[model samples]
Target: MPELAEPIVIVSDVHLSARSNWASKLDRIRGLWQKAGTVVFNGDTLNLGLANRKEMCRQAIECIGQICQADGVRAVVLAGNADSILDGPRHLLLKGGRLLVLHGDVLFDSISPWRRSAKKLRAARDESLRKMPPRMRASIEGQQASVTEAIRIVHDRSGKRIRSRRRTFLENLVSLSWPRQILSILRAWRDAPGLAVNFMETYSPQANCLVMGHIHRSGIWHIGDRSVISTEGFEGPRKPGVAYVEGDSVTLRIARQTGASYQPGKVIGRVAL
Candidate 1:
């Protein structure tokens, strides 16, 4: 493997497929990749459920290969929940194991049935789809479609419930006692960062910083000396963000839409490892 250089840019949850307008977004990413010494794709570079998996994977690989061939640029690609069907490294250790980069899906494996099902489908499809007879392939595809539809229904209901609860919580927050408000805030904090902390403790305790993307929301949370940085996805209305690493410092750079193109805009957050 080639050694990655300093000032590495980490992006995740691209979710590239034939249906999405990802080519222009990728071109923007390529511009950023050219300026950085290394580029790390944190995961979900392809959406297996929404496209012809084999062809999408091939196209993704070809595009990434071109990026890697850029002068003085190195690429590290890791698999996410959607693209786990492909063979590649699932996680990376950097800065002598002080910093870890991962897709963040592992944290939800036990709690998210949708994620678990998707992972299983990817594995089964990858292992058998090509070798199976046409009838078997049709059967598997039918099952996958059913499962995906069920997941979509459940996800929609869950999202609505979550939004309602968030609104109720905010409305009640103003009337609550200071102690109760503090507790509510703490509980909210515990939801995502708690999962990240538990995951790191179990899998990569030596890591003081983690760069991950699975949840679309982007933010940073500090757990003592360990910090978790989550980046926004390319598919969302929110500007796509990257974690720019330089020596012991990491800065979050979100893309700014210029007149005709996107460019690295501002440092929204930073952390020292």
Candidate 2:
């Protein structure tokens, strides 16, 4: 047998549900394994809780676990919002030599529950937005501000992210502390030196690649001599791949998704992503 190359493949946000079409995607995932010595299953592998829906989430999780543990290699996973209680708190994921894997939520301590996503971000969430008095909303939009920033200010000022969506929309309209409150928030903060590497900041105190998952965007950055990298979510029709590189190689490549690579049975595309 040919010697398998040691590769670190980072993958995240595979919100696999029972209904999701994932089997076909797994075929391409095979491309990662023959070369991978380490696999990073970043998080959100499950859809989460509902009396009626928990089963689907469970199946998704089981399927993901199976995929991660395959190929007789070790895999690391992080927690994600959709997995909620199962999102396994900080420190669940660790890689060698200054590589840190975290879900990126527990960093701030208080997290808006996963259930709140729809009510908060939905396009028709106007009643929730109406209370903001227009100008502050403009600021958030202006800075391309993170929703975490908006919610943090409201959370700190009134001790709530907003007042039941109905009343929260306007509470900030009258608060004098809005500006200061937004300034003070510790957005995406981590107490651990290794875990602190962000796409924008240095990866580790010693400085190496910092790999994280949570927002589900694929990215790479230079951290001193280190590289901070992330692979986008595999769920929701994203163009996803598990990347592999070897022997301190400078070149990295992403394989194309099988489904979109070809139309009606041509040939699956393979391109850098």
Candidate 3:
């Protein structure tokens, strides 16, 4: 695969939609495009998982694409648990395969294990994997395929669950973050780094740095020889982290909102790939 442009900026879990503050976020991301040669939306750019929001998701994607075209910035959108319908690449290998970027949902068998539907999601994932040939199941592409299928299976039925309530987006978010769900989220955050390291060791042994965003925790951990980097989320409680990749190095920085745009803030971590 060819290399992305120099000074690539990667952000994930932006969750752009008509129901959220997507317009302002888009302005910030537009600023991001102006500062970098290429911008990668690591995953969950929009919540296509919600059947009711499919139209909104489509509009959000189109708007992003249009802006990218107008700005002349190369944009890459990877599929996430929420946006599994996207046909883009699920993972990227950078710096001669030493740096891996993915959405991070594939790190766990249950995907978003904190969700109320986690059991059903895991069952769907397991059934999909079981049907795959053993050789294919061992490959990264096959794993992504099964994950996409599982997401589809669960999310298709999720329409009924979501439509039963006519709550605002904030209310929906609050519902997902209830007390029990908070505990589950905390558990996932604690376990994610180790699972990420094991994932790279099993699938991409050449990669020493794994950059991902799903659990919405922006931090970096050094696990023996490997580094697990979570870029955080736009819709979460914490600020987001933007990963800048240039040459053989990757730097993690906090994103600070300045006026209508977001700029790279303090450097929290760095890794040599």
Candidate 4:
């Protein structure tokens, strides 16, 4: 029998928030956990910024550590928006060479969903007070709004703040119709530094693979001989979870449980790039 080499695996967006769907995928993670050459948390392992479920977030981090240590694979830990709540390293573990590990939220507008939600709710409440009975509205106005433009305005301000941090966020926004706040999300696989003026539209010509574990939209963008891939997640009922690849001959496989991990959880199955 031919000697079997360790398989390369990738995972990300393990949003351990109470609302996330990592239960089913984490149970199965042990199966793939035992085989890979490397395991990446890709970030957002905890709902660190969330208002509730501290215990759940803690469990998620512990579980990730357990899987990495048990498997004997080098674990790459990066920060997601959730992870940013604690304020430590932004990202860790790069690829083979000098590629830095990225949490992707650095490219984001805001790393704290809890904060963002709170502010929006506050703005909404204030706006609603403007319309309701002053007596009853006084209390509710302190919480959220009932109007549309108030929320929109608050969100718009958030985008401007996001652009201040990451140039990539602003640059990428030029391509989409999505809200500007999305631009602030720290990104995993940026446009490879100086590859192109348009990072999202650019691709590597000499690299084997450009790996990224954010966006949750799993698919590979190939340009010439280069390939860019977005890692799936364990947050929702999506396709093959987060993934990783090492070569061109390798093909990306979407597993039975690879949809929404939130940041970058490894619930994905990998064959080739």
Against the hidden reference, what TM-scores do the models get? Answer: 0.69, 0.50, 0.89, 0.49
Q: For candidate 3, report its TM-score.
A: 0.89
| Candidate 3 lDDT score at position 256 | 80
Q: Give the TM-score ranking, best first.
A: 3, 1, 2, 4
Best candidate according to lDDT: 3
Error of 4 at 228 (Å): 1.4
lDDT of 1: 0.67
Worst 10 residues of 1 by lDDT: 109-118
Task: Please give the TM-score that candidate 2 achieves against the real structure.
Answer: 0.50
- lDDT of candidate 2 over 1-273, digit per residue (tens): 133335656566656555555555554464555546865565565544321265555555565557656666655554454454353333322333344454454332233223233234322233334555566544323111233333334334443434446555466465455454433333222222233343214223442554555644444555345554545555535444343434543222444555444111112221121
Every model: Cα RMSD to truth: 11.1, 12.5, 3.6, 15.3
Q: How close is candidate 1 to the true structure, as a TM-score?
A: 0.69
Whole-model Cα lDDT per candidate? 0.67, 0.44, 0.83, 0.47
- Tens-place lDDT per residue, model 4, 44-105, is 66654441345655666666666666767655555554454333444432333222334443
Q: Which parts of model 4 are misplaced by more than 4 Å? A: 1-8, 18-25, 49-60, 86-101, 107-208, 246-251, 257-273
List the candidate 3 regions with Cα displacement exceeding 4 Å: 20-23, 49-58, 160-177
Q: Give the range where candidate 2 is weakest over 10 consecutive residues by summed lDDT.
A: 262-271
lDDT for position 264 in model 4: 30
lDDT of 1 by residue, 1-273 (tens): 445787798889878876765556577566656578888889777785533367766777777767567546777778766666656676778888788887766555322323423444444434444555666445423323333333344445555776775556676766455675455435433566777777667666788888888777678889877888888676777777778899898888786767645677788799898
